[model samples]
Each structure stands twice: as C-alpha cells, then as structure tokens.
Target chain A: MANIAHTVHVGLGDRAYDILIGDRLLDDAGALLAERFPGRRYGIITDDNVAKAQLPRLLASLDAAGLQHSEIVLPAGESTKSWDLLGQAVEGILAARLERGDLIIALGGGVIGDLAGFASAIARRGMGFVQMPTSLLAQVDSSVGGKTGINSPHGKNLIGAFHQPKLVLADLSTLDTLSPRQFASGYAEVVKYGLIDDEAFFFWLEENQAEIFAGGPARGEAIARCCAHKARVVLEDETELGVRALLNLGHTFGHALEKDTGYSDRLLHGEGVAVGMVLAHGFSARQGLAPSQDTGRIVAHLKKAGLPTTLAEVPGTLGSTEALMAAIAQDKKVSRGALTFILTRGIGRAFIEKNVDPKAVSSFLDDMRG
Target chain B: MANIAHTVHVGLGDRAYDILIGDRLLDDAGALLAERFPGRRYGIITDDNVAKAQLPRLLASLDAAGLQHSEIVLPAGESTKSWDLLGQAVEGILAARLERGDLIIALGGGVIGDLAGFASAIARRGMGFVQMPTSLLAQVDSSVGGKTGINSPHGKNLIGAFHQPKLVLADLSTLDTLSPRQFASGYAEVVKYGLIDDEAFFFWLEENQAEIFAGGPARGEAIARCCAHKARVVLEDETELGVRALLNLGHTFGHALEKDTGYSDRLLHGEGVAVGMVLAHGFSARQGLAPSQDTGRIVAHLKKAGLPTTLAEVPGTLGSTEALMAAIAQDKKVSRGALTFILTRGIGRAFIEKNVDPKAVSSFLDDMRG
Candidate 1:
C-alpha cells in the first residue's frame, strides 16, 4: 500500500470495517482489496461524472490485481437517487451476476455512495459494498455513517437502510478534480464536526483553514478527525435512536433549504448545511439558549471557508417561509404532528429537542429570511 | 380479544414482537392495534384478491376503533413481487404520508407480507409494520418471520431486508376464504416443520390430519406449534448465520422446481416443498443417511394431505435434469462454485450440508424424474 496515510477503524462488531485515507491509496486499492477480500469479484458503481474523472484509475488498480470486475455507470447527479435509477443499479448488479458475497464499489461522491450503498443493501437480499468516496463531503460525512439511502419525492433520504460498508477508501487526490465551490461546499461538514461537540477541532480548523484549503497535511488530518468523530457517534447509535441524531445538527434546516431549491445546483447539500448551522446558532441565540456571539462567530468561520452562512447568500429566490416550514415538517427525523430539530446550547454542544414549537421555528425562519 | 387462542412472542431483544393467532382475530385487530400502537396511522397493503376478501372486514374494524388507515391494492399473484411493484408499494406508503412512527399492514399472504414489510423496512429509513397475514401459508410461515423482499429476475426472494414487524395478526377467520388447493398448499410448510426437527410434531400431524382439514381446533394448534418452532430458530439465528438454515429443509430443491415451473400456479410453492421434502428423504435414503421407509411415510402423509409429493405431479413438461441442476445451482443459498442444501438423516434430523456434489444432485434428479 503506497502512502498509507491514515486508517480509521469503525468498531461496529461484525459489520465493522476500516476507512483508509491517503494521497495514493487508489494506486494500492487493488492490492488492499485483494488482500482483505480474497476470492470475491467486484462490481464498480459510479456516475457519469466520476466515470470520466476517476474510473480509469480504479479500473487500472483492479486490473493490476487480476480481479474480475463489472462497471455500472449511472447518470451523475442528486437526481440519480430516484427509484428508476435505483432499479437500474440493482438490475445492473443482477445482470452482472454478482453473488451475495460479492462487493459493489461506490466510486463517487455522496450521491453515488448513497445510491450504490443502498443498491448493495437490497440486491441479492443484501450484498457487501465498499465506499471509494471521491468528494470531500463524502470522505468525512456520508461514507462513514452507514446511512445509505435515496431521496423521496416527499423528502430527502426518506427511503433507505442503515447498511454499513465493508470498507471506505478516501482518495485525497480525487479532490483535485473538484471545483472550488464544490470543495468549499464539503468544508462545511468539517466545520460541523467541530460545531457539534468539538470546540478544539473547530479552533484547529480555524487556525489551519488556509493549509487545509491548500491541500496540506492538515486536510488529511481534519478529514480523519471528522471521520473519527462520526465513527464514535455511529458506534453509540447506528440506527440514529439517540446520540447519532447529533450528526444531523445542521441537516434538518439544511434539508429544508435543499427541498426549497429542488435539490439542484442552486443549493448543494453542504452549502445548505453551512447556512443551516448558522441559522441553528442564530435561532438558539434568539431563544437565549446559546451565546449570541457564537452564531456570528460560526458565520464568520464559514464565510472565511467560502461556505454560504446566510439565506440571502444562496443563489436564486428561496421558497416562502411557509414552504420552508412545510419542508421542515416533512423531514424524516421529525415525528408526525411535532417539531423536532437539533438545537444548540453553544459552540460544540448540540442536542435533540423534541416538541419544539412550530410557531417559534417559523418566526426564526422568517427572521433568517431577512 | 374474542377467541384469542394463541400468542407467540419472538424474543429478538429490543426488536421483539408478538404473533397473535385466533378465530375472529380480524374482528378484534382494530382494538388490538389501537391499544398497542396508539396514534400510529396504518397504510394497508394487499393484493386485489385479499383486498376483496379481507380488506372490507379490516377497514370496518379499523373504522370502529377510530384508526386512520389507507389501502394500497396491488394485483393478485407472484408477479406482484417485482421491482415495479416494490416501488409502487414503497411510494404508496410515502404518498399516504405514513411517518416513520406510523405502521403499514400487510393484509394478504406471503407476497403481501414480504412486499409491505420490505417497504416498511426502507421507507423513512424503516417504519414499524404489522402483519395481517390472511393465508394459511402466511399465517404459519411468513408472518412469524421478518424476512421481507421481492424476487429478482434471477431468483425468488433474491432482493430484500430483515425488518421485523411490530405485530403479526394471524386471524384464523381469513383462512376460510382460501381455496382448497391453496389451503393444502400452505399445509406443506406445516408438514415441513415436523420433518425439520420435530418427530413428535410430525406424528401428531399424521394423527390429526382429518381434524386440521375440517377446520377443527387442531388447525390453530398446528399453526401455533409451527410458529413457536420458527420463533425458537429465529431467536437462535435471526440472520440465518447457523441454525436458521434448517428452516429451509425442502427449499433448495423446492426453489428449483418452482423455477422450472416458471413460478406458476401449475405448481404452487408448497407443492414444490412437498415434492422437495420427498426428494430430500428419498435422496438421503439412497445414500443410506436416512431410512428408506421415511421417504415412503412422508410421501404417504403428503398424499393424504392432498399435496403433490412426486416430480411427476408438477403439471406441464418438466425441464430436463440438467436444466433442473442449473436452476439448483442458481440458488441464493448456494455460494459461487459450491452447493449447499438442507439434508436430512430422517424426519426431524435435517442438517446443512455445505459441500454437496452437483453431479450427485443431478443424477438424483434424473432418478426422481423416473
């Protein structure tokens, strides 16, 4: 394994697997997979975008190991998470005759990881999958959580399973292909790890933000820390019964904004999360639950990181407050006839608050829209 | 609670649930559901046949109990277990706006239980589900187990999940509407439990066959007994890591026969099982692993139960032995390039044989055809 920079093991009992992070882990991936998962062929699932950018490297690696492999390239976009595309992915694996013990490789960002992981979850009653997360957001967030799913017409990620991956390969080199906005979009989640119960990590990110942006060693360190933090939460609550809900700190509001913009380029998920975290802190401050200055401080850090921190910063006109409230109401995490949101007490301290008043949330959104 | 005769609790730790069996249980289901699942609306999924025969009764009861409910009526048959239908069932549940805490009721036979339960498993990352199994096959088998899914074009039940239900209401009254052939078909599974690990139960069924056919008290007793046996096996191995494989005593051969018959009504699932069980015994006796008379005895009993025990009984021109061998090789339980089957020493002495010879199996099928 060339340049094996970091290995984070998720201790999920029998379902546990390791996440490998390195500059050239992709080069050694075939050797790693051959060594760890002997005797099984591979089904490589990617999207059109990743097919052009990163597919050849992975294909070369697998071929070098003499591993049998099949490829399922879907149209690249958040929309690929629809039922039709899911069927194609599932049928693709079946057509390729991958057995239950075989592994499907999800070689892309969050959308590809979620869709491919979900297809693996149901194909042949369940198959193992490995995550080759190419996006910065995926490396630190979706890839490690075992939360594989697709968005519903009614809401985001409303249909899925909590199927863990057998392994995650975060090839740092893939980030070089990411657009500046896309890279900044992913940085929001790094900020989230620090915001949700890790003040020291937040301070570290603040000090090393420039270095991380410059692709320095701090970037790998920060991604590993984020994964490690998420791994701990997932271990405590794999099904999101409790502490794992903290991982959705900015997601509840973020998802609402995503729905408002129709899950398009106008609002990337991490960008929404960046703005959502700011709103969370702002709303908490308005309710006197968190320090007022904490919200401004979070906004400043996110702005410096090139993440959207305010509703107005989002491109295009957002939906009305009522529509945003309706979107929030439809969130999978929110129970029927009740408002539940991950509210913050201050920096590095987020908690799930059930039975939060809808009127209060609406007014906060109204104020934020200004 | 009227005429409530049997209650089997599957102790899967926190995922534990109850299987309630009783005459007129459908009448009491509304009250039972209301009392147990307060404030949770239900999305009822059933095939057109069951919807006609059982839906009105369930709806009346739910209305009586003031329970909010929605019905999704699919076409009646095995064809309903497809990707399109799975998407329809899942989207139906979502369109009905059944939240994660809400419930979906599978109100038909095995197909409905499997499809609705799978939809619940993935919808909103899993909503709680209840089984209102309306066929003898379902009441005795699928209702008790949490195995849920649809068939892949490659094989039956090749795509799905293991999401347990909140409750299983095996209302005995629903079985009255089943056709005689369908009833006898479901009886094959009842006989299977006896063959797997309960010689005494097998003997008891042999004695009470007339009573069970006449809809006497022995019918409920037999179902409850089968459920309890399955529950014990499930508790020992929920994900079929070990002991649970025993439950598929006749399934390996049965699945192949079903595939050959194109999963058509010409040879029902239980008919295939009946024939498969006879084959298992006959094959074991040929190898001197089981008493030769055991096969004769099982054939006699299944004949008396009106079940098809011989390959010749499966209507239509059969595939050649080689074709049958290929179908058997395609079994999900059989790993790549290896054969696994639930073999029997005698009645109630089935064991998993992981390395069965394909040549031997093919030759045995040739002899059985004669």
Candidate 2:
C-alpha cells in the first residue's frame, strides 16, 4: 500500500543514475531526493500547465523535506524548447543562486526536460539534474536518455548537449491529469520500445491495452519495462555511436511530419511518431524487409490507442513527397547527406539502415500519401 | 630548416589530442589537419583581424589539401565573446553544412577559440573541432585547456561547456604580427606556468626573457612547455574538480580586475592577470604565506615585461576595494557563496585556499590600492 515503485538503473560507471517509477511519487519526492542528493538546493523548472496541475504537490513534498528551492515555470508547448527559453532557464537557475553542486529538477514533460536538462548540462560546464517527468513520453523515453537539447530553426533538437540526469522520478499520479489525447500521444513512444526490439512487451501491451491505459499496475510495469530497455541501450552506447541509433525508430519520419506541420499543435511530436511508426513498418514492407501484415498490425494498435497511424490521419497539408523527403534530409541522424533510418523487419525487430536511397523513400512516401 | 615544431599530447584517453607548436604553422596546417582528421569538411570560425591577416594562408592550405571549407568572420574584439555571437557562430557552422564528423577550425585569439569551441560543443550535441590559435594568449593558455565558453552579462564565462579540440596548431609566425602589448600580455601566462609549480622554469623564463620576446627557439619551447603543463592538468581534472583549480592561480583576482575594467581594451585579460598575479603574491606575503621578496620578484618580472603589475597602472578608474571584492565574489570559482582563492606560498608554489576571509581580501586590496 506504499505505492510500489520500480527502479531502473542506467550504468555508465561514474555517470550512472536510476529511474524510479510508481504512483504518488510526488508525495515521496522530498524524501527520495534528500536521500539521493543530500543537502543540495533544487531549482525546479516546469511548464505553466504542469505548474497548474503538479507543481504544488512537488513543492509541498520539497517543503515537507525542508528542502529550499526556486522555481521557473515556462510556457507549455513545443515552442518553449527554443534558445531564448533555454537561456532564460539557465539565467533563472543562476538567479536562484544554485551552484555547480546544486540540482535542477525538470518538472514537466519532454519540452521542460529537454530545455531544463540542456540548461543544467551547460551551466557551469555541468550540474546535477533530476527528471520528474509528468508525461508518459518523457517517463519512458526522453527523461532516461540524457539526450538534452533545444530546437534549431533548421531541425528539432539540433542544438544541445548530452547531459544525463542524476535521478528520474516517473510519478504515475501525474499521468491521470493528462488529457486522453496527450496520454495516447505518449503511448506512441510506449509502443516504440516494443517495435524497436521487445516482441514480448509489444504482445503484452497489445493484450493489456485496457489496463495499461487505465492507470493500473500494468501502467507502472509497462513504463518500468520500457525504461529498463532504454537504459540498457543507453548504457551500451552512451553517445549514440552504434546500437543507440535503433532507439530512434520513428523519429526520422516523425521529425519530417512534425516539420511539415511547422511543429504546430495540429501534429504533436508523439502523434507524428505514431504515424511514423506505421510508416516505418509500411516502408519496411515496401522494401521487402517485412510482410504487409506487420504494417497492418502496427497501424491497428495505434488506431486502437486513439493515435494517428498514417499520413492521411495527420492533421495538416503534408505537401509533396519531395517536401517530406527534404524535411527528412534535415534530420540530425542524416550522415553526410545520406539518409539513415531505423527501419523494421517486423514488429519488435528494428535495425539501423544507413544510406537508404532518397528516391526509394520519396517513392514510398508518394505511395503512402496516395 | 623544417620549422621545428613540438607536440604536446593532452591525455584524456579517447578524448586526447595534440597541440603542435612552431613557426609558420599556417603553412603546414593543410597537411597537418588533413593527416589528423582526414576527409572532413572544415568550417573556419575566425575574427576580423585574423581573417585579414591569416585567413588566406589557412584557406590556401585547405585548398592545397583538397579539403572543402567554409569560413565565418566575426568582428574582432573581446566583445565578440557574447551569447549573440555564440548563436551566430553556431548558426554559421550549421549553415556551412558541417555535420557531426566535420571539423570546426577556431582560427583566431581566445575570443574566436572560446566561441567556436563552444558552438562545436553544443552543435549536434558536439562536432569535431581543431584550434588554430593566432594570438599568443591563445597559443599558450586558452587553446590547450579545452575550457570553451562565451561571456554572459551576469559574468564572464559563467556559461559554457568543456569541449576538447581534436588538434591545436600554435603558429608562432602569427605572433610576429602581434603588437608589443599583446605579446607581453601573452607572456604573463607563460610566466604563470613557472609560478604555478615550476621554480626552475621560472628561473629559465627570467634568463630567457629577451629571447622569448624576440621569438627565438625559446619562444616555441616556452609555449610547448606551457601547453604540456596545461595538458597534464586537464588530463587529471577535466572538469576543474581538483588540481585544475591550481591553474587559476591569478584568475580570481584577475577576473575582478577585468570586470572592473568592463572587459574593455583598457585592460587586456592578460594585463589584468599581470596585475592580479602581483596582488596574489602580495596578498600571500600579507598573509605571511610567502616572503615579501617573492612578491617583489613577481612585480619586477612583470614590470620588465611591460605588463601592469599594480592597481594604479590600470588605465580605467577602479571604483573601490569593496567593488573589486564584490567582483571577485562573482567569480565562477566561488563555491557555495564561499570565497575560493589560489594563494601562493612563494614563486612556483601555489595551492587552493577555500573560504578566504572576505574582509582580509578587501583590506589587502585597499592596501595594494593605497
């Protein structure tokens, strides 16, 4: 009845840290943080939406622990992941009088985590940070990766650093406050872990879809399992030199969709990724790497989760296939003008395919759009 | 003569790189960089002054090596080390289409090196970079340490990342174009290497001052030795957690003087450091850590090098000892509101002194001013 928590450790020798998953983590944050960090001031960075819904609880926990803190609440949106806001967050942390030894608490979803994590990474060359991810997307993915960054006009997350968090507290209670749309958007990444490599987890998610979405024990287990998978991948390749690229399963296509929509609300990151995962499967089938049944299955699961699963389901005008290809070419993963994508052979069997032909991808996009 | 060059290897394991020092390194840069990095596009970030004097030679070298290159020339001055310029440098590098594997060549003094290095540090989570230090200050100090950053209104270098370069080319021929004042300013750091922990090096500097100023073999040897010392310190403490702080012997006091001068031409960074070194030694004498003769020897040496060794010699109005003390308090070296100073026992014997009494420092400043 203590609200059981699961711990996933990311092992990088001296830089190793743990992710704690459970319900009611906000109430326990004070004690957990104090026990882990010990006598450090906290600078809390959250988005306005999270501030309205979650900040008070987190602050109460910090106060209960007698931990002194200062908070900066940024606007809630992808646009908040800009250079100006990143500078503001860093300056705010400094103004709060946090030193190199102090810790920054990223208290919102991926935007806040990415922005705050980046600010922490570069402040005083580096500082300790804790990720209190309030969204499922962050809980299972971004918060665990240590890939903190801000968006550039040229591309998403093109400017930033790889600064890992000292701790991550994925409080399940916060997920309940998320709109069904937001929750499902994040579910795309949740399914991503399965599509990347874990067939059993994918099958488990397929069967427990109801419980997973109902905030039951399945939710916690799914999040924990996803984090564990991510941690293992990150530990093996901290700098994304090799196997880590597999983690970007839907991102190449996803980033293109997001860019096509100008990163507007009409196409949320996770929505783009949802559709992208389907496309990745579809493209894999088109490339003769997988059967069309795999693509159909992925699309079915995404649709069941109330997530966008195809180019047609995307909200805006996605322009020509050539334009989408152009956007894809701008992806950070593109190497020396060559396309690099994480294409799947089947469900839970994705592999990094480098120098994928642009013409082939463009023709596939044309087929998908048609 | 093959223009004898010396190489100092900074040992940071896989992050290790070499600093090559000699005359006319600009002529050899094409082959040197090609041999080291190989088949990578080079994005050159330089200041106007360097572009005017050294760009053609460097460009010719790249062309000779058949390497693709793009260059961004920023206005020359200390002021270029700002967040705005940092953004421009980053954007410029990206515009050049330099990817993660590409090399960014920082081809100017400290300002260019710091700005370009920082841009490389965050662009694409980091890109490869090489240092072609044209100024003497950079050749001996900033270029070797891998401490890259831009200045903030809050404080100088209060924000940045520790990004090592792949190679450093210290072209002594470029120093021939430096004004006497610039050369003397750079000599301060060279003298500092000896003052930090090498008495014999200090004695050798005293003997070879003329040769060093005249740009003889002694000049390359002195630069190479300083780089070697810095390389060792960085390898041991890449993040300034311990022994690396010793390298900031005069920086605490020097940063205050630079701030007092508003980081203008009135006090070149090295000039402030010249006077700051004297103050540090004087304060050590005041605290009975070293004999007065040690302070006198330091002042005499700086004076002989045409460097300012006293507060009265500073070109601008330094408000008050209290103001100077306040500036020192803002130093990045300040740990948790505690004053940290690198006070010396004598020439060639410096150590970290934490929580130094603020009042004691103020009175020492007052006495020095009087």
Candidate 3:
C-alpha cells in the first residue's frame, strides 16, 4: 500500500503523463503498469549496466503479472547514443514485432532514455513510451522534457525528436546502486533547477543538502521539487521555442565542455554542468548582469558537494579556447549564426540571450582557463 | 500569375500548413519560399537523379531571390531510405550548420521527401522543412500526409515520424519528366483517394483517365483533388489513432509484396498497391463483404494505367503464402498480434477490421496466386 511516495503530473493536454517516485515501486511495477496501460505489450529498452542491476526486477514484475514484454540491452555509455545503436535499438523493436499501439519502456538513465525514446518516436512513425529513470540526472531533467534524441558526430543531441513519455517511474531505492561520483554528478542537475529561477528553492536546498545526500526523507522531497519546477517550465513551452530554453541554463556551456573531453570519463555530464554552471554565473557577473557574490556562493556549494566547479578541476588537459568556441558554435542553440545561450541575471533568474557574441564567449573561456 | 495552380490547406492547429500544386512552381520556388519563410536559411536535400533534372531550377530560383542554401544529394531509389543514408542526410544538414531557425527543403520524389523530411524532423530535435515534390507519387500522396519515414530490412516505412512540413509545393511541370511507367505508377494513389471514401471521384477518374494521363487540365485537377482528400483525413487524425487507419486500405498487402520483391523494380510500390487494392476487393467479395464486380472494375482501370493488378504480372517470383504472411505480420499495422487491416464493405466504404484471422488471409493469398 505504501509503494508510492510522491507523484508529479506533467499536464501536456492529451500528451500529459504522471511521474511516480518511491522506494519499492519497481517491486510493484507489474501492478502499476497494468493499471495504467492496460492490454499494451511492452518493449523494454535498457543499457547493459541497468540490465544487470535493474532489468531483472522489472522483468520479474511483468512476468509475475503475466504481462507480455521483450527486452533490448545496449552497451551503457554516452557513446551508445549514436546512429548505429539507434538503428540496432529500432531494428530490435521491429524484430520484436511491437505495434505502434504497444509501449516502449525506457529503463535506464539519460543515455538509454534518449536513445530508446527517440527509437520509439520514429519506430512505426512514433509510438508511446514510458520512462523508468534509474539515475538522478535523468529523473530530474532529460526524462521530463520529452526531448529525446541521440548524439551526432557534429554535437550531442543534434539529431532527435520532442517525443513525450506516457509516464515516468523513478524508483528512489535505485539510487543506492549509483557510484558516489555518479550521484554527485546527477546532483548538479538538481542544483540546476534551483539556479534556473528559484532563489527560494536554492536556499531550501542549501538547508536540506546533507539530508538529501544522506538518503534521508529530504531526498524524495528534493527530487519532487525539481520535477515540479521542471514540469512548470515544460508546460509553458513544450518545444523549447521560448520559455523552455530556461531549462538549458547551463547546458550550452556544459555541452561544449563535454565535446572538448570527447564525452569521456574525464568529465561526466553532470560534472561538466557543475563547472558550466559556475562559468555561466561568472560570465554573467563579468557582464555586470549579476552580483559576483552569487557566482562565488554557487562555486562553494558545488565544491562542498564533491562536484567540480572549474575547468582546471577537469582531469584531462583542457582543449584550447578556439576548439571549445567551435564546439559552442556547432551546438543546436545557434540561431542565424548567432550564439544563443542561457545567461542569468542572478541565482534563479536565468534568461535566454539570442544575440550572444562568439568573440565575447571566446574571451570568457580564455579567462576561465586560468 | 500562372506560376501557381491550386493550394490545399491541412489544418492541424498551429502545425497547419499549405500544399501548393501548380505549373512552374519549381521555377518560382525562390520567390514563393522567400515570401513564406523569411530569414530562415535552407538546406535542399535531393537525389542525384532529381539533382540533375530539377535541382538547377530550384537553385536558380533561390539565387534570383538572394536566398542562402546548401545541398545534399544521395543515390536515387527506395534503398536510399536506409539508416545509412538517413545518417548521411542528418550529418549533411548539421555540417551545413542549419539551425532550428532554418528549414530543410525536401526536393525530390517520395524517396527524397521521406528521407529528407525525416532528417529534418530529427535534426536539432525538430527543425522546419518544406516539401517540393517532383514525382507524381510524392506530389499526389506522400507529400500531403506528413507521414515521413524510411524503410527497414523488415518492411517499408517501418521507421519514421509523423512530422508535418511548413509547406508542400508539388511542382506540376516536374511530372512531365517522369517516365510514362512512373507516371502511371503514381496514378494508382490518385485512384486510391477515390476508392477510400469518394465514390464520385472514383467514377470521375474512370471517365477522365485518358485526359489525366495525357497531362491535360484534368491532371492538375486530379492531383489537387487527391491532396484535398488527404488533407481532410490528416487534419482529423494527425497521429492516426482512429480513422487514419483507413488510409492503409491496401498498404498491408502491398507492403508484404514489396518486401517479397526486395522493394525493387520487380514491383514498384504503386504496382504492388494496385494489386493489393484488387486483392482487398476480391477478398472482401469472397467474404460476402463487397461486390465481386467492383474487383473486376478496379483491375480494368489499373491495367489500362499500366499497373500490375495481379501477382502473376509481377516481374519476379512471388513468395509462398507463409513467407508473405510472415512479412505481413511484421508490418507496423498489426494490432495486439491479431491481423488488423483496412477491409472495405464496398467502394468508398473502407473500415478498420481488427481481429482479422491470419489463416484466412493466408488461404486468400493462396487463392489470389491463381
């Protein structure tokens, strides 16, 4: 009866869905899915890591309920988001003979969710999917926005679709399996919600930080709050056409840093974001757009959480300013050859700047290099 | 100006767009596009064949209007709708640095339209695109529906997205270059609109078939009529949850035969569809669901248009009933493992028939082989 802990609904008209967060939700997944999506066969798309740790629980649940399903396990890594793996995932879905009416269950973190969700988007000309995010970064960010895609050689997430999921199940207990670094990396995104436009939430997180990290009751509340904030922004601009760009507060810079590292362990996605968030704040202060103290406070907060707060902290030798600038120009946010970025006025007061100057960006990166 | 002929509006709320059918449209593409989508850069995706025949006209038009654009040309044929080509197209667009503010011009027949349109749908997580269909098959059928996709080894159009274009320009003069066989092959889809729900249009085609074939005034009228009919269906069921299934009246049977033929010249798509349409009627008649003579009438019309209306007329070996059944089961139209098909009661009276018996379909194919 207590399988559920908290729930957030994403109201996108007919495309709207619910997000459930709990400790033992995976144990009751069979009943949960059966009650929500009746008569639909499931195609569970997961990564190798999640398959060993999490797939069996979901499979056991479905089997116990006598619900029909198939599984597609791919290599687990940022590199898995490619045209080759995308084709394999889709071909597997087709080989399983899952109809458009059947549902695709994306059962992993951002990489698997983005790949599987994009596969579902194009398979049979778009199928419904549900996200079962096992990582904190995914549960708070990628899984909610319906922004599903794979990375191109040109850049990360340069090819994809805005395909929303029918539901999202975030099992709180699964967080136990993540390495300490992975957990901290995902926490960077949780911090992003507060930095985007919620000063009050940022203050609240500072207070509840230790408990959330310790797996206290505050952990569930923190995730729910992040989801609710994201749900509000997504509801306002589902397509990233306007207000939704706010969600990319640190992503534009984060992506360039990721590409600089060849998207490797030298910097995890969230680690890149932790540094990028600091850079974003520092750049805003340099532009006289915000108080310098706010940027300093953010650096301290992220540093205390065991997250990298500067480019110098990235293990590998950093790429040149020119190379990083080239990556930024190639990012999907460019408009009419002008750089578009999420620049902030202060903590929780981010805004979309469409006419960003590339020279300014290069200069900022140059100064940050020291 | 005599540059334009007819325009059909597909109203899907904010996603609505116009389908323009006319003579000299390709020559006028630059001006037309400049007027409709100002400030957006363009990426023209076409086939090598179309690049030779019609690409110059479009480029000259854009040049005259002072528009910026890039090109990506692939080999011509159904095989170009593979994952490899799709990757090439998306990479080309990204390499061209076409941002979300830009637009992709799908400038060729169904193969290019489906491939490029799909690329645009996924590139940068959904950019704008315009369809400039040259071949009759694309102009009359594929261009208007927003059902863009590529084929899988398993089946035709098994991978794709329902991404609507900003606008669709079916250049009538381009059809003049089509081989007579190719032209007739496209006429099958024109006849399909009439058969789907418009008995009067079917009769009209029967009466004016000669003039339409001769490229008379009736040709433009026929194409416009088909576009209008498709527009209505798409507006009502953009994602095809219900009535949209009617559009697949002959697709189930057609797809199996196409797969059997390796999607080659052994049986062009329209030829397979012609035979499929006849089989649908014949099967309906055998089941006491339709008038037997209607099947005969359809065969006569299709034959006169130089389309194959029987399996024996196909250029290569016909697979056994079991093989064809296997392909049919693998098609995207199957529902809950039951044979779901567009089975009609009579002409212009198609209905979605779920729970269709696969054994009956197998035996029916056995009878049709004779």
The fnat scores of all predictions, in order, read: 0.80, 0.54, 0.99
Candidate-wise lDDT, in order: 0.90, 0.89, 0.90
Interface RMSD for each of the candidates: 1.3, 1.1, 0.7
Off by over 4 Å in 3: none
lDDT of 1 by residue, A210-289 (tens): 99999999999999999999999999999998889898988989999998888999999999999999988888888899
Instruction: Write down the TM-score for model 3.
Output: 0.99
Q: Alpha-carbon error at A232 in model 2, in Å?
A: 0.6
Decreasing TM-score order of the candidates: 3, 2, 1
Evaluation by DockQ, superior candidate among 1 and 3 = 3
Model 2 Cα lDDT, one tens digit per residue, B35-95: 7777799999999888999999999988998989999999998889887888888888777
What C-alpha lDDT, on a 0 to 100 scale, does residue B340 get in candidate 2?
A: 90
Give the number of the best model, judged by DockQ.
Answer: 3
Pairs of colliding residues, candidate 3: A197-A348
Clashes of each: 0, 0, 1
Question: Model 2: per-residue lDDT, tens digit, A165-276?
Answer: 9989999999999999999999999999999999888999999999999888999999999999999999899989899999899999999899889888999889999988
TM-score of chain A of 1: 0.99
RMSD of each predicted structure: 2.1, 1.3, 1.2
True contacts kept of 3: 0.99
